[model samples]
Target chain A: MNPYHILNKLLCEEEELTSEERKAFVEGLKSDPELVRVFTGWLQVHSHLMERLPETKDLILYSLAADGHADDLTHQEASYISDHWKDIDSVVESHPGFKDLTHQIAQDRQDFLDCWGSETASVPQVFRLPAWSYQIAAVIAVLAVAAFATIFLVNYQDRSMQLAIATPGEYQRILLPDSSIAHLSGPATLEYNSERFGRSVQLTGQAFFEISHRPKQFIVRTNEAMVQVLGTRFGMRSGNDMTQVILESGRVQVASNETPPRSIVLAPGQMTDVVKGEAPTPSIDVNIEDELRWTGFVFLRNTPMRKAAVLLSSSRNVNIDVDPLLMRESVTGTFSPDIPIQEVLDALTLTLNAQVIEDEDGFRIVPLFP
Target chain B: MAASKFDPQLVLRAKKGDERSRNVLLERLSVVLERFFKRKIGDQALVDDLIQCTLLRVHSGLIALKHPDKFKAFAMKAALFELHDYYRGRHSMKERSFEPELLPEKNYSINQSSGDSMDVEKALELLKPRTRRILELREHGYKYREIADILNISETAVKMQVKRAFEKMKTIFAD
Candidate 1:
């Protein structure tokens, strides 16, 4: 029942104290000065270990085995505690309180283990986290990942999809809220409410669409052409010289105000290069993913240095100059848009002995060896 | 309400992509952030600006905020981003100026006070695992009685370990 015995049990593996006995000691501490000081000191050590021992648990256990679990008790530790157990033994000969605390701590641990065992052994099945926590964790993780990926896929899809006829302004590819795809071309701007699943767009400069297969109709309309489809791949062009429709796959009946808008069976590999007030002429050899390569891949392996440099310039929307002397070297690497310019330079420097120097305008590649 | 119980429940809801749950977490955490950032950013003006920007990002990006339980670290990172942006934007507008040499190696006044707390943590590390457990329960806002109950040790045992831990801290700090 003595506080010291409880304290000792806590320090040693004496055993867990009963809940009622521990509670009484807590009440006793309010009136005891020595108890207050001792408790505070224990707190200091406890927190210190908790914060640091996360990665050092095994090491501490190893030390425990070596040192017999008794931390080296220096003169200070002795003074801090009984200050020479033998001498204090006579002074505190009547202090039966000390051993009991240590004993209770051990007893309590045993009690806890007993409780843990009963709960565990009674069940034949493996323990699992609470249902709500497991369900919530799974749902939250999936949704959060989906939201992130949606943002990513939508951005990537936007880059690869373009609006046929854009105005003479900054072109932006829009992932229609419905997952239907469209690339904003020319100077025209296309905006989609990604929060909503409606595949509606207003067009200026022409764009193309690989509309996602869905029950809803995907619609794109410009001043010249209004095109509708169930689910198809097609390209439309609106410029000074012409308004054209190129169908890569699926079917689209192209109609326009200026031209007698007629039905076009645009099969695979068909390019409808249309001029306003003229017949729709289908063409060939369309590099769809390649055409949008600027928004897709800035770094290409085994690509000509000059061409890669040009691609990097447009892709990053930064002006970069390559030393003409290194033009003949074939460049090979993969680069993400998020890569820092320094990292890019480091890769080049390591691979080709190429070094990059910087100025206010941009970066210039210079070879260290050549 | 119990701090331990409240934190995990809020964290669970927030992690489950509940925007409201995240808002509650941020609200609970705003107090912690105020304390955390006040310690880091000396200037009151910049601190306020950074806090505002961080909260704005948290609100707009709640659904996008992946780790809801690690709200404290997440918010701190947000503040860091805001600070980076502010300095970058300011650099663009201002003329070139000489910057002061901030030698962190030189121990300052604030370091002295915190240095003790650090010593305390270090000293606690020297104790055996059981002693360490008893000490941690006491520090994490647990009552000696509660710690005894939780760790199944006697209150006196908890007290002894605490005293022993303090002595260790004093020594560690002395070193």
Candidate 2:
């Protein structure tokens, strides 16, 4: 007999498997690493399915029982219920939430019935209007709603805001009305009212913000803390009842969202964290490039090509060799880390009329002609 | 019984671009999928997402289904795919630096507690649909002979599928 058959019989606890076969299967699992791995995998999948997949018959019967319609069960259903009453009862006893599940099922069934209107109902011919009239009425109603919604949305848009969400595996770059830039990491949401514009935004997860200088302070708020900046670049991450703000090139004031909030000002290359219901921690020095790596935005402001290349190579885990003469040349640009390193290098070299060459070890940036 | 209740004629009509039939089919499927998901996962929001994703999968894949009679299996397969994707996402979330505070409390708890193993679900995707069906049925407490009867194949064929599924899983685990 196949080992899987024996395994299946053992899992099912069937008496059909010979004792010798069962012993052999157990012994193989104990002795062979490969067999043990496969068996473990099989068992995991089996348990997961058992836990996730409902026993249709039991579920149907349970729903009926929970709904107080046990009397309506068919003869076969009643027989199965009687035979498996202990198992069914144990399951129901364990999952107290099954009642809510039945209620949800009833609601779902009602929704289905509502969507699938009475197909069996017959309308009197005298009361039936021409199909074209119904269509025309629907079109008119739709137009009226559309017109109203358009006006409402126009007003609502001014008052409420726009929401930008970056799901897992996505990096989104958004430009605020004031020409400020917000680079959102995956699994993050940034919401800001258009009317409020670049002044303030609510953030969840993590984001790097480049704020434009303005009279009104630019603020980023999270559940735990708030960050206020003026014409500065910084990365803010909020989670686990704590918010951390790291200032890169400018100053930022971090404060707890709690009442009587204690605040701390973070200078360039410094970071602070605000725990829930507490004051912001004192600013501590940090490596700005390392801290903001998640945003994948490399901000270079008149930095020499040598330093830029080192930063790029470290951030992207690639070796970049710049030509000797070009090392002293300065590069000024904000590069999105998501773009391929090669593409970014190409674009960067393009500005200097230089070329990028690829080799097995990594990439080398040399003068276009030399 | 759920499979028996699914009308292949409606699926055929939906495949032929019958809007009314498609709407009705999807509505019924939504109820089934909701129940299927709710039983497994307690998060209503995740259940709702799974239902919508599965429905979309079924809708898009409906055109490619050659045998309308296999609609239940097809729909179930779609649901399985969505569920698998959900588990896979949860697994990857563990490997990555996901902000747990961003997830709703209940969903966070569920995600943290489940899919902690080496994830055999990915390996299951390598099996043929028929073989997968047999393995799933067997896992659900159906005997090999019963699964063979349900799929209208011989008992030996069902055993073969089980063996093949395990062999495939073994290779995946080995790697």
Candidate 3:
């Protein structure tokens, strides 16, 4: 029998197993190692699913218990909790490991009540009218009218304060009225308004901008540095000392083009870095996509380790820890953020001999290559 | 039954200082809770701790519930109160015998307790107090929205707490 069939049989738990059928199923599993692996994997997945949900069986038991007052599950009358507890005496009585902990959790209910009960006061009645006051209903009518009028006159008035969030590895395409395309990366945020307002955007974290080739100047501001491009296809990265600009197309000069800003002419495949308070460096050949991975692409032609890892972390919406010494280690390879974090970590480990440790949020990388 | 009968919109509205809404909402959720618990507990003495409290908590903290779509999960969280409370009562008495027919026998081996017990315990300990409480609620199969109401926190927070708790657990287990 195939693994899927075996898994289905296991799940359904039907069809009495004859001696011949049992032998055949085991024989089939043994004969094909690949099938056995799949079968075991399915079994493991089921086990996890079961563990993921603890009280389902108890819920079923509750449903079958056929008690009348217990039927009102909405009210915690102590009837249901008593019967459906996952760890009963039978399960924990002999197991010394679970006995103390189970009892501790059980006994702690009083403690929770002591803390929580004090704060749970009755809801106070809001402003009220006379018991039969006609004005009470009339007031509601007036408020409704005012709310509708305000909504009709000015739509929501909330674009300024609302923060947009994107899930990991998901891309949000924001289109400005001026025909500018912004591919916003997950785990990064940028706030902006229409061109009529200021034609400026406040970018706190990392993002890519293919600014519309417009008459007015387009500016992107970060804490470390600012990049002003007019109708250009380029990526500017700024944060701390790691300010960089990778020009892909169009002709645009950076602001206050001083030696410190590192004004450098670049062709198709060059990237420049302007360290905070330092001059911008000369053009060096690099992968535009890798440098701009937060915006779109993953592989860098030649990228710093920390930058690459940050891109992967942004893609996964995970915080990663990296030792300071490993930030400068150069890498020339490709990584797909859409791929599993494990696979990406494996690539870094096997290729660079780095050690990755798990944290509550994500992973930390320590350099072992040296 | 019609889904709207327990539709979360009415319940939340009542929780936020509306009396009529509260009565209507409570009445609706009561149906599901009653059916679920009546079958599970088989004891009237415990119903109040199991079902009544979840409803009351949901009623009192309805302001915290944002998503009506997650009502089922919230109800499940509310159910956890009874389970945890029941365990607590049992702990006080050191009573071991329960509705024993449901337990899986082989998992009761002596050696099994020492290894898995400490790992689960520490992970439970590391959780934020609210998360620890919520996990206990969730483990007992309380509805997600009910948990939100009882904790007076957002559903999103509950989700993040669970995810963080599990991640911490995975690390501890691995270690």
Interface quality of candidate 3 as DockQ: 0.05
- Model 2 misplacement above 4 A: A1-160, A195-198, A299-334, A338-343, A346-354, A358-362, A367-370, B1-175
lDDT of candidate 3 over A119-164, digit per residue (tens): 2233333564687676777898799889987985465345333344
Residues B118-140, candidate 1: write the lDDT tens digits: 66645644666666565443333
Q: Could you arrange the candidates by lDDT from highest to lowest?
A: 2, 3, 1
Tens digits of per-residue lDDT for model 2 on A280-333? 888889866567777777766677899999989877889999999899888865
The predicted structure with the larger TM-score, 2 or 3, is 2
Candidate 3 regions with alpha-carbon error over 4 angstroms:
A1-45, A48-77, A86-161, A164-288, A294-344, A350-370, B1-175
- Residue clash pairs of candidate 2: A296-A337
List the candidates' TM-scores in order. 0.28, 0.36, 0.28
**Superior candidate under lDDT, 1 versus 2:** 2
Model 2 gets an lDDT of 0.67
Best by DockQ: 2
Quote model 2's TM-score for chain B.
Answer: 0.53
Tens digit per residue, CA lDDT, model 3, B9-79: 66666756788877876775665565445334433446545667878777655677666555554555465
Q: With candidate 2 superimposed using the best TM-score fit, by how many Å does residue B111's alpha carbon deviate from the native?
A: 72
Per-chain TM-score, chain A, candidate 3: 0.35
